[model samples]
Target: MTGPGRRRAGAAAAVTAALLAAGCAGEPTPSSTPEDNRVFTNPVIRTDAPDPQAIRVGETWYLVHTNSGGRNVPVHTSPDLVAWTAAGDALPELPAWADPGRTWAPELIQLAPDRFVLYYTVADRASGRQCLGRAVAATPLGPYRDDSTGPLVCQAELGGSIDASPYRDTDGTLWLLWKNDGNAIGVDTWLWSQRLSDDGLRLVGTPTKLLKQTEPWEGSLVEGPFFHRHDGRLHLFFAANAYDRATYAEGYAVCAGPTGPCVKAAENPILRSNEVASGPGHASMVEQDGRTWLLYHAWPPGQEGSTDPGRQVWLDEVVWSDGKPVVKGPTQGPQPRP
Candidate 1:
């Protein structure tokens, strides 16, 4: 296993090379200059950082992903989103209800300057299903603590719940979106949403069923639901198909509100498998300098399930055309930086 120090050193060397090339080079050519400081290439994080969720706090960009490398929740940090350095595990210890080695899809939300809540999916030993849990910390890169005796959300009848993403609407209302793990038990997978308490430690009122898998490309499941409000509209983005297969892709829907009557876009799979990358889904969006970028993971072409490099992190530009988001990637070659 690679130590955290070694990972950081390797990332620093890559950044140094990128900076030097950008500084010394005159004009960028296809062969001579593939990447520069102003530009970047795919697989920004060339490790197993699947189900990536990123949040920008101040000027620093902090990212956390599914359990990998023996850590409960592997965390990384970036300044410009191109070069990333490993920051160790965010959730170092699991709660009493959770079983070890099954933590996944950690999503972060900052309520106050001193309060950060991390919602994560973990295996509930008592319920024998994957369930949702939340942890509290004072900073982005946290040794978050979950002291709850039970899960925050676990729809065991619908095969439990995972991929808990938090969203704060324009009206100052907080909502949580997630998918029932029905695919785990041969049932229908539905994206659901409900209001969250002000402190973000508990759910409020009743949960609404948002949407489900009906498109051809979606196959039997739809997970990783997140909300992005643009142009006075609430758009729900999700990943579908088997996560470990090349057919896994991303799509979106337009919703009426936080608890929506959502309509799927005509362009169902806005992002899908390409020659450069495969299984491109499970994304989080970040805005910097008025530009939107999608931070997601993809398998290297023809290596859909390899554990060596695993699902590496990739960044792509989200260009809005006629009020709809069009991802300009699974890009292989160099493109302008965020």
Candidate 2:
């Protein structure tokens, strides 16, 4: 963790770093009780970081996001979830079949002891399609490279697939979930799930459709499905609407098992645009210090009544009230950090 004084004196990049740090850099965080250490502010990182996904390795946390250009996926590390610093690009280069400047939603997961997997979406230039690819590395913060020259999954008929996420059940069954992008072709996006081999490099089962963009709040898209099992039920948190617009929001569904016959929660769009922020969606959830927290991207308040050009990453606590999950924010003001 970075000290308050040193963080305040660091460069402009340091200021962006402080926005995501644990304590208000020079201001004292309330420490009246053990819970006080979890208090911090929002807008964890004020840069254009979208579709943020994270994994906890031992005592450290590593996060990766949608980096369309530059190197492959970039990694950010933090001792406590509140303070984060750019580690480096996870994948040194793109796969030979995909084009650069098109990586989206890079997800990191540890399959076994020191083995980690990096799943991401990239655009194929030759075919003009978007596809999902997987890379492997020994460490969470990676210099991961694709073991194969081709993508692990691609939907040529439906155009392509994006937002690849892996879900491991209590029974140790690995499942891969992703969306077959149909928005451009005038068809609604479909969320699909299939079983993955133990190594996470091979698909083994039949693909099942989970949900699609049918609700009015979801607009024309429903992508980025995150899976979590709690209270004897499987919950899938997904983002809706256009990623670049103010209507983007997150909704969830409750399922009987890993592959369902799932049903959407009646109270849809659990997190949406509020007065302080806009376009809050495409989030990743993690458990830290025994509390669950959400990391998502939202556009800051725009100037002259126009939306901000870049989306910034924000973190908030997820509290279950009366056994139902609720997000504590879309907070613009300083709040307790995770």
Most accurate candidate by lDDT: 1
Tell me the spans in candidate 1 whose CA falls farther than 4 Å from its real position.
1-35
Clashes of each: 0, 6
Candidate 1 per-residue lDDT, tens place, 237-291, comes to 9998877788999999999998889999999899999999988999999888899
**C-alpha TM-score for every candidate:** 0.90, 0.86
RMSD of each: 6.9, 7.1
What local lDDT does model 2 show for residue 183? 77
State which candidate has the highest TM-score: 1
Instruction: Give the Cα-based TM-score of candidate 1 against the true structure.
Output: 0.90
Compared with the true structure, what per-residue lDDT tens digits does model 2 show for residues 170-194?
Answer: 9999999998887756676889999
